[model samples]
Target: MGIPALSLSGLYSLKYGDCVRLPSGAEIGYEANVNFRNSYFIPDAVLRTVAGDIIAKEVFPIHLTEFAAFGWAWPEHGNDFMFIWTQETGVVKEVENPDLYNRLSQDLGETYFGASKDMNVNTLWIFNQLKEQGRFNSDHCNTKLLTW
Candidate 1:
């Protein structure tokens, strides 16, 4: 998210599906990039419906809705501030390749989330967004200098 606010913020490559277990046993998802449309992954939700958390609840109903809101599409690695707080406590343990959010969203039964399931759509979105600013090139497709 916010690079863990570490002295070596840009050192580690935090990939999607990369998880850090909190001392309380909760696992938080690390959004590696915006190449894939990611969501707040509930590890134990039925595929038929999702989006019940407060973060989504403020925009979406407690259950499924036709008008689901999307994030700004700013191409951010994305920060979960609550997760960052837990990491700050120094009890977070880095883990590799756990069940990730965007990967699970692909299996959602709702048609409203169809776009998020497609990885290429996000890839193109990032490319176009950067290209408009004259920052994109063939050599920098995977570059992490994505934000202002």
Candidate 2:
């Protein structure tokens, strides 16, 4: 972005004397930013260590495709995130694989479920049901996962 009309040099005056001058810090301002994380794609290592065993038995079938992030959350404060993989914390938006979602939705015909609301429940319920059917047994990534 271009500098705003008023910046360090314009906001303050620096007078140079015969042998004296303003300290280096007093003459300018600098700010820089660098982001290293992607909005999506949690690293594989994090998923295994942070919450794998627990998720395996409790939330099977919904194995993480990749990546993870953790934080404290509360439902009453609207800080609780959905317990399903999402592109951008989306609750009902299309899942990463629409084919998988369609298969699950079709399989669960009339069953009702949700997480915070109906959509997430439906998705989670599908995951459980699919797991029961062994649909995820040959998942490509799972075959390569080295338990940590």
Candidate 3:
């Protein structure tokens, strides 16, 4: 499954059992509740490249609300989030929590995924490809410049 493009229109916080109108005009509700896990937040750089639309500075709080409502887990590792970016659709794709994924997967009796060093390198490659596609802007990228 392809990750859905960030629908700026549907970007909003949701609460437990709250109804949401998706960009597709479908009304949906959280099957569960949402909560934010700061410990799992992927760094800004990773969010900007793979799932940029959802990570604006002001959106963190909303993101937290949505995370718990949807029972999502934030992936601590960069590569794991990118893999998520490659597999889901709509705002659901922006669900970058690996911890959440593992939990849900276990509940649903699905296999869990782990990262290898090679997978990490591949995620970097995908980030570069996104840059080429104009899905990323270097200016928005979080980077450090060192002067000697």
Candidate 4:
């Protein structure tokens, strides 16, 4: 039997076309550019099978510009990837407690699937590519510097 894998649906934007406050009380400015729109961030995620089987789970930080640039310049025929950016300085990392991480991941997954039942294959491909690029490697702290 083939194992069912969880897929990513649309990203849920926490903020849209405005300044975002970081955990450090600092703010990241959102300048209007060719690549500006509402943005989404998945602080963590968990995957499961339809049979109520837990497949895998993970926790990490991601800031994608594509979700914000959807209508502006995204989902091109062959170009469906976006750049990931992170705060370089003056940012405090919120220590994710295990319980909170699990809860958030589960909630995010449920919310995402509840809103949209279909997954964008192209976006998933790009996300996998980013993973291969070490952008999502939890072992590497420098990966936090990911940006477009």
Quick one: best TM-score, which candidate? 3
Clashing pairs for predicted structure model 3, backbone only: 33-68, 33-69, 34-68, 34-69, 35-67, 35-68, 73-97, 73-100, 74-97, 75-97
Task: Tell me how far candidate 4 lies from the true structure as C-alpha RMSD in angstroms.
Answer: 19.4
lDDT of 1 at 6: 33
Evaluated at residue 81, the lDDT of candidate 1 is 21
Stretches off by above 4 angstroms in model 3 are: 1-101, 104-121
Worst-scoring 10-residue span by lDDT in model 3 = 57-66
- Displacement of the residue 29 alpha carbon in candidate 3, Å: 34
RMSD of each: 17.2, 23.0, 17.0, 19.4
Task: Summing lDDT over every window of 10 consecutive residues in candidate 1, give the lowest-scoring window.
Answer: 44-53
lDDT of 1 at 3: 61
* C-alpha TM-scores of all predictions: 0.17, 0.19, 0.23, 0.18
Computed on alpha carbons, the lDDT of every model, listed in order, comes to 0.24, 0.23, 0.26, 0.24
> Any residue pairs clashing in model 1, and if so which?
none
- Residue ranges of candidate 4 with Cα displaced over 4 Å: 1-31, 34-96, 109-148
**Taking the tens digit of each residue's C-alpha lDDT, what string does model 4 give over 1-148?**
1121111111112221223222222222222111112243332122212222212222122223311111011322433222221222211112324453333323222222111324333333333444445422332111111112
Which scores better on TM-score, 2 or 4?
A: 2
Which sections of candidate 1 miss by over 4 Å? Answer: 1-53, 56-98, 113-148
Pairs clashing in candidate 4?
Answer: 84-146, 84-147, 85-147
